[model samples]
Target: MPSIRLLVLACVIPLALGFKELKHVSYTQLPTSISSAGAELFQGIEKGTADAAAYDWVNHVLYVVGRTSHLMHVIDLTDPANPVRLFIHQFTRGEGFPNDIDICGGEIAVALSANREVNEGHVRFYHTYTRGSGATDVVLDGYVTVGPYPKSIRYTDDCQSVIVANEGIPGKDEFNTFVNPEGSVTIIHNERTGNPAVQTVDFRKYNTDDAAAWPYRVPSKYIPIRPTVAEGTEPEDVVVSSDGRTAWVTLLENDAIAEISITAQGLGLVNNAVRLPRKDWASKKVDTSDQDGGTHRRMYAGLKSLRQPGKIARLRIDNKDFLITADQGGVTSFTNAKHGFTWTDATTGKSLAANIDNPELKANANDVGYLGRLQVSSLEGKLFDGKNAELVMFGGRGISIWDSKNFVSPMFDSEGSIEEYTDSFFHDIFNCDYIASTATTKSPDTNKDTTSYRQGDFVSGLDVADDNGTVYMVVGMYGTGSLILYEVDTSAKVPIPMFQNIVRTGGVEDTWSTLYTNKKLGDLHISDLGIITSDQSPVDRPLLWVVGAGSGSVSIYNITESLPVIPGR
Candidate 1:
């Protein structure tokens, strides 16, 4: 029989051996410059700058998309410590706004939104490295027209095709009337060839009156003017299967996922759409009120949350594929005060209390420190119900992992871990909004108001890396500009995610007055993250690249095993 001391040692030794830490190694800022067309780029620095980034493992090059800047900045990461800004490629006025970018097979694909989001967009292709004599010269292979508001772009694992998600957001026309375009997924085949074939898949077949009977939630409120289910379905992000045979798109506003089958001829077939399960807060903890003084998490019965995922990534474990989502919720709200037209699917709890029939719920809604300040989706709930009203909120407030084969329920969910982690280590700035500042309208420190501390941690960017046989996941907190690392153990019957370490990459200052100018490793609003495995890294170790939209900076960190080796064998 094992002694008590030996049993204790066995448990303690594994805990100590599994320790890990993220060490900040290098940082660089995206430069703001005037385009050749004489247009000033990245002018609205406060609005955000860097939006997305992609890494080239072969050449050790990094490509960053400038959201407000309308430029693509290329940097050399040969030396992990000192990243060199190689050059910048400016997109002309006709190219539109670049939202996301992906690289494969020495080719780069960029998803660009039209000048008007409702109009048609384009996907421009370029060489990863400049072919021209000049270092700043960029060689454009060609461009293909895609659906409106192209938000995400990715290359298939085989590098034979590129998939794009066209958001197709509704907007007003010259007459100030709403024009809602049908959202779609565009597949470009033979991308490496000079001429590529394009095929766009739409949801017209699901626009019938019986659409309500469909499996997914087709909310009519998304497009009030034209409530067709096809136009209401917006694709936020897309991820392709490892074998490049299927693709999944996240319909954030609708709380659904659309699966499309990809053909070898570059065509896409809309197979099915499944609704994500809503989380019941009755058993889970959530901090619902921004008016609450500090991090006060509580379980509220009858309150449900939508897992409106903003980003999706595919991971293969034991020959099975799993989809991970960053449930950063969103609401459809449009206000044209001049035109006296205001439409929204969101409302404050205080305003909703008037329609609540339950006595206890009504009281909680009225109390400023409880649910009064929390914003919830009005599209749901029983506002019309004479007796009972259910509270439906946006976002899962964390991450969820769903089996690719089964979309009904998630295999694992980090329901309250994100909030608990932030509250435990960053209590001073718990649930802090990255954009909140004294100069902005959402300022929390203007009069020493602590409302911003209750906004909750917004998990935005996520990526997974495999070090040998061990799988690891990294999550980026947009609100606080922090990163959390978790080790995914697949040896169990069901995969288990163990929290390993959390690090604050952004400024630690409690106030926004000095947060952006404090010269931190990373800044606020982490828009995207990429991981370079030890095999692909120049330093022969794992590396994490984080892109900050608020501060327009790119930060890199080294993932090191913090466990000390035994003195002797």
Candidate 2:
């Protein structure tokens, strides 16, 4: 109303970048004695036996997969620590056993043979750069029946599409026990132009009430029963969502978590899903039959005991829309609340109240029976997506915090729990293998009441440290293999950190399954942490490259000192 009326001005922007500061400290012991200063290559020369669990760091070179020694080693970490092996490929089929390895562009995929006796080809692909040296050509392209094994494998950072976590069934068989159910996930849509288009998606077509058929039987050598497709849901791990469209498979027997949505007119089923029902899902089910009747006879089944499936991380809130999926044990977090993922319940830090059941929300089973396992600093979901958006979970018996805000129907609940760490016998295992280099974790008190956030243990292959968010988690203990460093709170809606240590050093036994780290070029490698990733690490770091499937040899280190002293996380 001021004469002429012409005045427009508006400004009000704050954004909110809080959370960042970490450095607790506890978990110690990463001294096979004390050696690795970083830098070594094919030391001994055997390169024969190696599990090499899971490692990936291309370009600068370093590709390994031994599964059972089907072999695949090519080291040359520019020099983050000194790894050298140039070449060594072997995959005559039958047990090449390579869990995970992806190298978009130059192409180099491997899931390898699988188990239960073996099934034709399983999954394999190579050409890392081809040429000569090894002559290359590990090809096989089409193969996957989904049985009692086929644990993990993921891609899509451009490497086309490859999500194989059949994980199959078998809670137990042989002579000790047997129940088996909930295990099936096959989403292979590879062919990012390279060729080999492979396409598949089957969890028994979605939900069959819980189908079965003698676990499918077939394989007395081939043809034990025939036309089958009815196995619970095992799905160990398979995440395809950096945008490549969509894919989050992870059933872990059956706690549940599927959100498929790729195009080309194919895999469009698996609609939205997120389960957490445990206590045996409810128990009661054990007909245990021989057949005769039909419906496969025998009935009653649903008791892998309470929660089991570990690892399943996916974050992308604030900006990337949203896409949470923590599923460590059964359901500490599960969100698609549109996009922003969700999870939290190490013990009960937060998020996860929808009704709270899955055995009280696990992780404190007396003190640490393993709630599940999680690792996701930021795949990009902004910072705490809707419906209470918030997550932070760690298992065996401690760590929990969920809030999830409430995206569309989001409501995880919880808010603060940390079972102290019940005695610490390792809690029950289930550390999910480990992966987290600092989402955020630091604060002696910093200020404001102190919300709490910190995590560690990306171990799988080891190699992370740009500024020292801190996380090295690769421990094969007893057998001797260490690398533990926590200090998180990089920014935290859930960074992870109760307190941890151990810090750098060599290993023994084989050092737990496989471990990998190439966050551009920091570098680290180990195996036996879960069982295999063989170890042909490559990183263009301070100079890091390793290869020792089992003493085959390859070493090099030169860090001297970085973080709290930098040992293990």
- Cα lDDT tens digits, model 1, 395-464, are 8888888888898788877767677666666666667664543533433223222432233676889998
lDDT of each: 0.76, 0.34
Top-TM-score structure, candidate number: 1
Q: Clashing residue pairs, candidate 1? A: 42-69
lDDT of 2 by residue, 77-97 (tens): 444333445645656545445
Task: Give the runs in model 1 whose Cα sits over 4 Å from its true position.
Answer: 1-16, 35-45, 130-134, 174-176, 220-224, 337-340, 383-388, 435-437, 440-455, 510-513, 563-569
